[model samples]
Target: MAWNEPGGGNNKGPKDPWGGGDQGPPDLDEALQKLQEKLGGIFGGKSGSGGSGGGGGPAFSAPLLGVLALGAAVVWGLMGFYQIDEQERAVVLRFGKYLETVQPGLQWNPPLVDEVIKVNTTKVRAASFREIMLTQDENIVEVNMSVQYVINDPDKFVLKVRDPEISLQHAAQSALRHVVGDTGMDLVLTEGRAKIASDVQTRLQEYLNLYETGILVSKVNVDDSKPPSQVQAAFDDVIKAREDEERVKNEAQAYANGIVPEARGGAQRQIEEANAYKEQVIANAQGEADRFSKLLAEYRKAPEVTRERLYLDAIQNVYGNTSKVMVDVEGGNNMMYLPLDKLAEQSQQRAVRAPSLDSNTLREITNMVTEQLRRDAAASGSTSRRGGR
Candidate 1:
């Protein structure tokens, strides 16, 4: 029989056999009522009252309470232990005071007593700043820059300053402005941007170190540095003019490089030509002098024959241009038709007299005279025939 079923208890059995006399069965309600009265009296409450005001209400009460306490403890322990990622660091604070720092992986702290703030110390942090300042030359210029950093010391990061990020930003701005103010505009725009970034980074690091912020600056980059937009056009014009000047200078140098060598080569060629002409002239003059000396020696050996040969050569040189007739003018008007006066003038200029005639000279002169008469007779015959016609 089941425990909750009706008449399922020990009273359901037959009446006791040991008692042969009339032993009646006990009343089930009376038995239950006396048992309830005894239990109620033991717990210091009224019998048959089903209220929670009675004490010692159920069995295993202490054990249940113990089990509940154990569960609560387990939950609290679970809440105390936490894990930090590889890129994070935990800053523990005990009762509003710094306690210790925890590295990555599973960590434990007392619950409700200690607070852990996990900061990504390994993550690279970046900040940008911009400003305008007067240079050493009293020109105002604007500079924009960025800085990348990481937290290397968690203790100093949590304890040193109220807000490390804000402090670092301010420090960076102050350093940049200070550096820009100390330099000139030309340097800032051209060669000094790198130097400026370096200087600002150095100053920022110094300030951060002084403040114990534990931020390590990794890189400083100069984004843009220039004159203000209002004067930007004027600055551009200046830069353009400078570039134009450089280009013009380079072009002039290129032209010189091209032309100078050609000019030099031409000059050298002319000089060589002149030198060759001088050498030819010198050689011709030397040859003429040697020939004249040889002629003078030959002339001294035979004066008459040399004079005759020279006269013949002179006559050939003078009369080589045209036909000419030579006549003796000692007899007056021997050849009236011929121009004797002009012939005499030419002979005086030549400084040579006609040869005197002897027997042999006379025969040669007679032959020359006979040939001239025959040529004159033929010319007169042709003229007479043309005139008759």
Candidate 2:
């Protein structure tokens, strides 16, 4: 039965394992002394000498505590082994103080004595949010944006900030607000989203660097921006109106481009025509002046002959254009006239109508008329000579 149960074994009084003599438990000091000796013998230590100077309890437990401590240290060291991927970096700290940053690979550090923080240096991380903010035009706009980043320095990322991602989130919000607040509502909701995103990225990176967050911002994207639902229709109408205005301006510019060149060409053509007319007038005037100058030189050599030649030339020119000629005899009261053009016309008509009028007969008739004119001129010249004598 049980060691403390009564009336169970051999019909004897209950036995005490501690060697009690009066059916009660043994003395605390004496039992403890015996137990210490037994444990000392088991651990290969000498038992107490039963004197004041010999104690085996401390000696027996010393080696056991050392072995336990060594085992704990070995477990702690094993716990420190960590594998880092190719894209990660590790930051090590010893005794709560900054140590060295380790590259990606298998790494180990003493547990409880050194701290290790692993960060993915080449992996891009993303943070995104949607918020409402006021614009420069005092209009409220809802902005949806995302920020992409990577850990540039693992040491700074782990050590310089209490929470790097939280800090990045706050910095991103601040930068987005600053950019949106400085822009007008039309730009925020329309074509200026790219510019705003670029500005937010630049400002956010600056803030992260200043705070030593070690977050390198890869890109910032303004996904969507618009007025609240209550004013969305009105904003759409405004955008359409602006687009129409731009289209009208472009059409007017195209029309002007088409018409302006044609008008300029017409004007240039008129100018060229005027210049050609001016050159023609100048050439005619110069030719007339040169002819008059040469005639004046010939007149200086023989005044009377030049005067008579000029008169005859004028008469010849006048007669050459007419069909009739008038001749006045010097001493006779009669004037002679000849219709030579009428005669030539009658002869050509007769030659066409009558087959009896040959070319030879027409030629002989013309020779007779020429002889009579020559004789009349000779008679007039002889009469003039007699009158002069």
Candidate 3:
């Protein structure tokens, strides 16, 4: 008989263990119990009906528990050893209290009793801040700046401040605002940028030191500073006007510098010329007075002769400069004419034609003048002697 046929072989026994004849599936509880019994047999035990392994099961041993505990302890102890990088420092704390700082390297701390916080001390860090702030001039500007810093004391960085970086940020912002407030907007935007940055850096450092933040500020730089965008054009116009004003002032100064020296030179020249004229006039006056005094002494010695000689000398000097000579013929009706002007004009024409006067020609002119003067003196003497007769 087939196994599927009911009551075929063991109709007295309960149907089929797998319930193959339209009994749907086996009972979940019975299947699970059978699985448990099979597992127990593999482990050198018998199937059990209660939770206590009532039939038979493997027993727990003290040796196994010791092995597990030893493994856990080893893992826990291993976890206590942590590595610190070359650029890092670790702060050691015991039972939530301060202890000592540890240098960078392989470090060990009691896992549960001690806490370690690793802080980067050798590496530089940076933060940037920006704001639209008011200046001492009551002007508004947008100031952008950055600060570079590093952790100097790991203990203070980790324990002294709750949040070191946050405190630094607040300090930096406050310092920047305070410095900006004390400075003029033009300076903050222009030539005073470096100074403002330095001021901010100093102020921030002071604040950090006061708070014991343990952050060393490396540098503070004002990255960007400008007027508000809405009125930037107006500010640019003002700058241009200021530049022009400066240029004009410089040009005027240069012009004055050039002109002032020339004027001073001219005035100095005038003063020197006046002084020279004064000296010349005074010298000429002194010379003339001395000559007159000598002439007067000679006149006192022989009055008549000296007067005649003086008159002749005056006539000679006057006649030497001109080509015309006028003579008064005493008691004579004839107007005696001497064409000395015509003669002089002819002489000048000859000189222009020849370009040079020969030595003999000059000698002849000199002899003629001497003879004329001699004749005049002789005539005056004869007339005086006749008057005496």
lDDT of 2 at 389: 93
Off by over 4 Å in 1: 1-65, 260-389
Whole-model lDDT, model 2: 0.86
Q: Write the per-residue lDDT of candidate 1 for residues 1-389, one digit (tens) a residue.
A: 44323342355444454642334466665565567667657755454444333433332246665888999999999999999999999999999899889989999998999999988888898998888888989988888899999999988998889999999998998888888888988899887889988998899999999999989999999999989999999999988998899899999999999999999999999999999999999999999999889889999998899899989999888866544555433323344245546765865665556554458865886689679866775666676667668
Model 1 CA RMSD to the hidden true structure, in angstroms: 17.6
Candidate 2 per-residue lDDT, tens place, 341-387, comes to: 89879877987898866679879987998899889878887887788
Give all TM-scores, in the order shown: 0.54, 0.62, 0.66
lDDT of each: 0.81, 0.86, 0.84
Task: Quote the RMSD, in angstroms, for model 2.
Answer: 9.4
Q: What residue runs in model 3 are displaced by over 4 Å at the alpha carbon?
A: 1-87, 302-309, 316-389
Off by over 4 Å in 2: 1-22, 25-79, 95-97, 295-389
Clashes of each: 0, 0, 0
Kindly give the stretch of ten consecutive residues in candidate 3 with the minimal lDDT sum: 52-61
For residue 80, model 2's alpha carbon misses the true position, in angstroms, by: 3.9
